[model samples]
Target: MRKLLICILSAVLLFFQARAQENIQLKSGDLIFQNLDCGPLCDAINAVTQGYQGNKFSHMGMVLLRNDSVLIIEASGKNVHLTPLKTFLSKSAHPHYVGRLKPAYQKLIPTALAFSMAQMGVLYDDQYLYNNGKYYCSELIYDAFKAANKNKPFFKLFPMTYKEPGSGAYFPVWKVYFEHLNMEVPEGKPGCNPGGISLSDKIDILGQYK
Candidate 1:
């Protein structure tokens, strides 16, 4: 009876351990979003945009698991590059969340990842414009899926707004950014943002991690 009870207890521990691992396991092509709390720029982004699942993500990346290691393909200050998942999560101020394309759209994963890999080393788009040689965080995802869909974009682009949520005036941070670039804020321009894509019907909220 003693031996039998010990075996049962061991089985219970193993079952819970497996369950915990499964919850943290991330599949390739999963989207991870975070609020980095980097500075005023991050603050401005979260203020003007919306998020799904009650999150306020200001940045995002695509998951890529290779040779038993997990990496994220993201466009950051250094441009589009692959970052280890552990390093990626460490940069977030709050717990980051994952989003996955619905099963019906899962078939596009390979093509999208391939396209994203091909874009490694591309410059980060500080101007946040479309069709430029550079790419911002969500723009990389949008373009990759668009390429995968043969230019028939799976995600939709909404006219961008830099104005405060209810106020007609543009965010002060935006004004300074564009002025430094010596260009006008591309208001009403067709583009994609992380917050907007998080609410996409094509994706379902997977889970989050700290």
Candidate 2:
């Protein structure tokens, strides 16, 4: 009877340990993500930009995923202007550049929008681009290290949740700041305004920090 009780207790402890390892929480900005699987995701992004050696494209963000929770870390870029998608679309010469976006590129849309709003610290440009005053859209990079990890579990390129009607909340630095202060996340109509939804109309995932 004693041996059986010990075995049962050991099984219960193992179950709880497994559960504990399933998910990780990134509550603070200083937390560094070491378990992030970057192999497969980076490969995927590289596949899209074959032979491209642009400096802007080389720089990327870091993302960590443990179980359901995912942490996105936005690092400062060198000489890169964070350009918004709407601004780019408005100025785009192509006819088929609005509303109609490729699914594969959706993961990049928010970062691109935020980049647009981010103040341009330094000036950098690609050889292909001609504009001296405005920045190009191709300079943004999405690091896919999680996708590359075959052995470890990783979140999808675009991490999303099903709690809300559409995609969860999205905000610029200002909006995120306000939200962090325990005030309401600015919610107005979607349009070309600071309070408006810069990205998709979908709701934002609650736990993830901007």
Candidate 3:
């Protein structure tokens, strides 16, 4: 009897959730509307979060919401948080670093993406926190990038700076994964960096090179 009651309750909860999703009117081409492919998406999400370790970085999860006009990307993480749009402009120390498109990027990009990437970078380059000798991949990325503060969106979130690796590939690809986007760093140059804006080439940067 207890088991049967539990199953009934679970079904009821699922029914409500499905109803809620149905009510969330979405735009025509938003990915969430297509098919719920949790398999690949979950793996991708795991990659990004695992990218950080040590030096105090947050663990963030992505949430996608679709509206009549736009797609929203909400982030929920351990230390990182979502600052309300109104409060963000005035309350945030680095307002310039905040993303304007936070509400519309949950599918591929979360609102706190830049900061998350910073954390990922730290993990990719472990040497930065070797002295501490106790860190994870994602935590290191957060510590290192937060220290550098070179990338406005990412830097504003990080309070301090640390030694950083010279390459984007240092961190786990899944967390800071850039699918179908081109990031040309000015530092590397020509053969190495080849700086240029992405035209429309969809490529995942986080894949393991080896």
TM-score of each: 0.87, 0.19, 0.24
Positional deviation of residue 129's Cα in model 1 after best superposition, in angstroms = 0.3
Write down the TM-score for model 1. 0.87
- On residues 17-113, what C-alpha lDDT tens digit does candidate 3 reach at each position? 6665445433321211011123443333233222211111122122223342232222222233332333322322211111111232233333234
Q: Model 2 reaches what TM-score against the true structure?
A: 0.19
Model 1 scores worst on lDDT over the 10 consecutive residues at 16-25
Candidate 1 per-residue lDDT, tens place, 68-157, comes to 999999999878999998899889668787889999999899999999999999999999999889999999999999988888988889
For candidate 3, give the lDDT of residue 73.
23
lDDT values for all models: 0.89, 0.30, 0.27
Candidate 1: the clashing residue pairs are: none
lDDT measured at residue 113 in model 1 versus the true structure, 0 to 100: 100
lDDT of 2 by residue, 1-210 (tens): 999999999999977755543433332111111112234422322332321122112122223233554433333333544333233223323221112123353454444434333524534432212224322222222212122233232221222111222445432443444556656432431111101111223212121111
Which has the higher TM-score value, candidate number 1 or candidate number 3? 1
